[model samples]
Target: ISSHVHYSGTREDRSSRVVETIEFTTDRGQTVRANPVVSDTGTVDRSGMSVTVLHDRDRPERFIAPQNGHGISARVPVMRIGFGLLFLVVIGIIVNGGRMILGQLPFF
Candidate 1:
């Protein structure tokens, strides 16, 4: 991303206009190159990984994958901690309000 500004004239009557450009360029050269050009670089192979599965008739049982449980039960203790802090804040507010109206501290 780039911006170019052109200023015409001196301080009293100066005027400027900005030209901005935002782009993506793959290759750079002295001259602008046009696309749709093909080269004779042999063959472009785009084949990726291949997976094969074989079944045997003599096997009595297939493989069983181990189960990975979710994080809900593990996160319950953290939620309980946050709830305990919130309850403490509410109780402190109630105690302070009662002490303010009663004209004395809640606990001496």
Candidate 2:
């Protein structure tokens, strides 16, 4: 079923979190209400919009929202920068070690 979504708050890095509750019935006649948190993106605020949810038959409590993967995550860019810095550090160490070894050679 569809439920209204509201912006709960933002993450540590200032990324927004949009949360919505999904109500559904399980195969075993169990009623489950799942609240799925998604990233708030786009030019408009989706606070009043409804969200769709998909649940596992075996485990009704385990559910997911289609919008979860719809946008680029806030962590992607930061992770890329972190990896790039790590690569540079590794290359610097390798180059320095190679220079030290080659400098020990008697041949000019």
Regions of model 1 farther than 4 Å from truth: 1-73, 104-108
Candidate 1 pairs with clashing backbones = none
Predicted model with the maximum lDDT: 2
Per-residue lDDT, model 1, residue 25, is: 26
Clashes of each: 0, 0
User: Could you tell me how far off, in angstroms, the CA of residue 106 lies in candidate 2 after the best superposition?
Assistant: 10
lDDT string, candidate 1, 1-108, tens digits: 233565789999998654322222222312221211211111222123121212122331221111121111334568889999999999999999987878874655
TM-score of candidate 2 relative to the true fold: 0.40
TM-score of each: 0.30, 0.40
The local lDDT score (0 to 100) that residue 89 gets in candidate 1 is 100
